[model samples]
Target: MGMHKDQRACRRVDCHDRPILSYGHMVRIAHVTDCYLPRTGGIETQVRALARHQAASGHEVSIITATPGVKRSGTEIVDGLAVTRITAKIPGDLPIHPRTRHHVAAALQENPVDVVHVHVGVISPFAWGAIRAAYQLKIPTVVTVHGIWGPLASPGYRLSELIAKWATWGITISAVSQVAAKTIERAVPTLGEVLVLPNGIDVQDWQLPVRQHDSSTLNLVTVMRLAPRKRTLPLLKIVKAAQERAGITMRIHLRLVGDGPERSRAESFVHQHGLKNLVSFTGRLDHAGIREIFAMSDVYVQPSVKESFGIAALEARAAGLPVIARSQTGTTQFIRDHQEGLLAQTDSGMASAIASLAADRALLAQLGEYNRSTAPEQSWPMVLARVDEAYARARHLD
Candidate 1:
């Protein structure tokens, strides 16, 4: 039939809606992803953190991924969780195991899990296969979509549903943000209303002592992979535009954190624009390194419009830095235009926001004060509570 059963299953579970949390026994969760540690990104990082938090919370958690191991495929205990790598020797080191369904099913059969929590991106064949395998085995499944599906991707998912009906029956679907969930609703309409499972962060880890920066020079920082879709080049352009708008009164120095294939292109843009003095690439840094940078930085800038959940932005906010990011991104969930930092609708608007912050130190200090004082609601405890709810829903569906 229809989604009648699914509707009943989700009748009480609204998106991010808190129900009376029933603290219960340990849940044996199996996180399935196409990628994991050593291969870092949003989904991989979130999955790892979620699994770790669940494990820390007395739940027995495991991970099944197609991302190749250091050598071959097998089970290994990573950070106390059993990680089963179902990998294939493929070119380009793609996280695509052709026999994902078989391996996933075999792993679960050998080691029973309460739920198969599949972390999916736009093109996660291994994750989709895990969903199918879980469905075939009549195991409870929850699919958390980690990316915003555009027009092409939405239709592509619908076509995939037509072929395999993966969005049907026992699957409980979710996304990282309302913006992302809306896209999934349009993409997998048959799944009905998708759930919102926001990403979590340990605030204490990112929380830095609030302090004022030197007014002579503005140290702007952004943490993101230098990818084309991430708009790294445009961020530099925005920095240049803001410098012009800010005039010679205040010097702006930008540090681009993280590295990707677009590093060379971004470097070329920096050189061509004569921004070598103002812009510097730190390559990639760990949490401690980023915190050290934030300790000395003035503002955190984000320019990606396709951001599903601005975890890095949240980290900067937690680090007590005023954030200036795109309005279209999921970062706007916590960051209001004048509240946390400034949200811009266009490139020029972002530049204007940066310039205004440079000119108006009081406003910047106010935003920074608000951010440091009022903590984000998307903390690990709240996120784990949401995870428990979603897992309960999936178990109920079975």
Candidate 2:
């Protein structure tokens, strides 16, 4: 026989040549990821939002993920979508479910989805299995790399880069931002072209927060998982330095609004640096609680060193709050320095920016207003429209 159909399916599609789907046909999409809620992070948030929108648009959508903890397996419905979880073993930061291939095959055999949408990361065993199952079942596949792979330039990550590249071969690949696309293209040159699909938020859900900034206190809020790359400790130090630099004129209260593996270490760093008075960690909050917190905050801070896209920052911007974040991040794509908010290059620069914003409430209000007005374009519908093109490309990637 001529080459098997699975082997022949490795051909790639031209980046811009995918035809847009004419209205009326609803595609059944299976979103396969390594993690999902109640575990919170950028990927989980985006996946949930995408599934919700896709379902609302009259398409059948389901999220397949590994169950957290030592449980064998379970299934639950959240946001009107079915979330299927399989038992897995946790290794280091990533989870490795040895039976992923079998579970995915089983799921495909039963439901037979149209597209297997896999969310890729540095080390995603489950996602890898989903791709394999896609090939086995002859299902079209779309793989989105959500995290930054630029740091993998080091020798240690060379093997991982090759493995991820190999697994993602023959798949329609996408990144969350232009910077992210460039990063992944550099890491995996053979992937041909990577599309930029920006992370989105439900802007209409985030009503502009009524800000009554207390002159006596400057509230700096950061909503992110307390992971190592997030630089939560550095954020605390910056808040302290900004307070010290601003003098007794204004006190800076830093509210950290998430939890992660690095929480204990972050708390230790706070106590060691005598930041007990300035910092408060609010484990994690749901959307309503987070919106309430954002409504009452002055400025939002993003101190992450390895951010692919800043969803939380965008949400804060939508909430009418000026953001002070590190420069050279994907957030800079939407938030221009001095236009929407201030972007800093270093810890010192971030501290300086914080103090400056705190001192000039008028400037803060000006930037916040601009960000809130411009933030609507990053809404879920706009993002999903672009994603539809990617889905079409995945289907036609002969």
Candidate 3:
């Protein structure tokens, strides 16, 4: 007699030839975040990368995000991952509404999932929902704290902290960075055991074509949102100082690619500093556009006083650009002093570093070479292995 499809016996051949069921068997992961594509930021990029990697590894992955506009609705497949954007009502002018949690919870109920990973921050309504759903279903949940919680000392922040403490696992993007990790741990003591997994980039995509050295112009680029906290004014000051102090008269061009609330302010500052010919602002470009910008540039600078993981810095290194970043935050962790790149102390110091590197082409090339060599360590393959191991520990499978 023929055996039923659902009632097939465990014969020797069937057991030996077929893949064995392990702990990671057909893992279905639901990534819940506040903002996603169509809205770009560090956390959005990181979650999207993780989802793509997970989907590529033969796991089913889906992302839930809040849709503010009428145009974005239903499911769409992006980069081999399924994305579902739900319609939310906005009572105020806020980009996201409180009802996002209800919509996300309903979606989770409709689609039973294995694990739910939450990216919690100031705007994480879906995170709140995902954690509550996971708790109700008794499924393992992981929370990645991507922002600084020190600014959130209000009642809302306290409530979010309570939810975070109950998470099965807490992951911080820059655990190796002492400043970032300590800041989070101080606010929420329960997050002391948080796993550290630095952000990563696709090294293959950033490979630049070898070009002959151009002696005429020194290309300087900074890829960041034109915001106040990023401190773009200081970067412009550095450019001015480089021109004045060096006296090299080498053509220095600054490419600023990103747009934000501070764009007008930055433009005014640039005008005030008479950097019209030297500085060019390319308002927010996609990854491919940014990659092209990186390829054309000789050096990358990040002057942000507040940075979590510095993914842009990693991308710059992958593209073989020598990076000079602020010495305060997560950027300092990735850049080794005088080895991979240089970390400047002040605006004057940053200007000095830029001037010194521009004067010496050989040193710039050497730093770029060293940075490219170190790119593999910050790739997604290495970062994901650490993430999987952390998930195993969170689920008590280890």
Candidate 4:
């Protein structure tokens, strides 16, 4: 279901009676996740950044993860942040452990914290275990859902509720976006509240050279892992459809950045569609390289309808480029239709949006200029405020 304006407006569920944390009080926070440093995916990166930001603000922060360290399992200082790894020697070093709850409980007992923040994807075993442990210890726990949990995952949550009765445990639940929160609400109706605590970005870092567009060629760029769930092939099809809609006179070049399991298949699709000349696949590029591309690109396109939060799309918008994203995604939190960029409800709609922008340079420039001048709401300061409030709310629950 699409998120209406009212639903999106309720980003933070209000807590009038709850006690707020005293200003200048030092807070000890423990962040639990399945992934961390040496494994830099979206969840891992967000958890790491959030923990570091908390630490920088004079709060004591530490991390407990299932991701292995150099040793099998140990504690180490990672970039000044203490990371406790509770991992076994599993194949591929997969972030999973049968005794995750036990280890997490031990870690929390070893160093008591004001709140335990657990990060989760659709089905994060380790994170769930950590939540269970925190609940058993009566520690104030907050869970941040970091992925799209559709109907397929509903049964698992139902089972979790049945087995653990977690919904009755008074833990504060949150999702990264409004759309995601609504879906999780539909899945687990018994939860007390599902807050919208979005991921944070350093908007200042994207302050690269202002984008100078060459209105001649329609240059589109998207940076994402080419996984099936990411809809890599569908992205290519949309780019092709947009080109066809724009007509042969308009030269369209799509820079497909990042690589994953679908890379080979997506490359095959591009070649089969006779789009080798129009689309170029660049496996992976660092932040600096992406900023350089942002300067040259006219628009950023993300074709994933299930994107919980399009961080790359946010980065592109931060770098002064108008973005094209699905209307149902968390990207909508930043990009409003016809404001920062156009939003599409379907693949054909996305194609139409691209073609419409290609035809109307005035609207395109206006959106781009608006994005370039305005800052996104997901800045560290604002996100930190929301997280602090979440912590306070969790403490109240405890």
**Candidate 3's TM-score:** 0.83
Across 249-274, the per-residue lDDT of candidate 3 in tens digits comes to 78777899988888888899889878
Tens digits of lDDT, candidate 1, 132-217: 88887777778887877456656456534632365556677888888888776776556677788999899989988866668978
Q: State model 1's lDDT.
A: 0.82
Give Cα distance to truth, residue 375, candidate 1, Å: 0.7
Question: What ranking emerges by TM-score with the best candidate at the front?
Answer: 4, 1, 2, 3
Clashing pairs in 2: none
Ten-residue stretch with the least lDDT total in model 2: 11-20
Q: What tens-digit string does per-residue lDDT give for candidate 4 at 218-325?
A: 899999999987888988888889889999878788998898999999889998989997799888999889888888899999999888999999899998899999
Clash pairs (backbone) in predicted model 1: none
* lDDT winner, 3 or 4: 4
RMSD in angstroms, candidate 2?
Answer: 5.9
| Per-residue error (Å), model 3, residue 127 | 1.9
Measured with C-alpha atoms, the lDDT of residue 34 in candidate 4 is 91
TM-score: model 1 vs. ground truth? 0.91
The C-alpha lDDT values of all candidates are: 0.82, 0.77, 0.70, 0.82
TM-score of each: 0.91, 0.85, 0.83, 0.91
Residue-level lDDT of model 2, residues 346-395, one tens digit each, is 99999999999878888987887786667657888788888877787776
Instruction: Quote model 4's TM-score.
Output: 0.91
Clashes of 3: 0
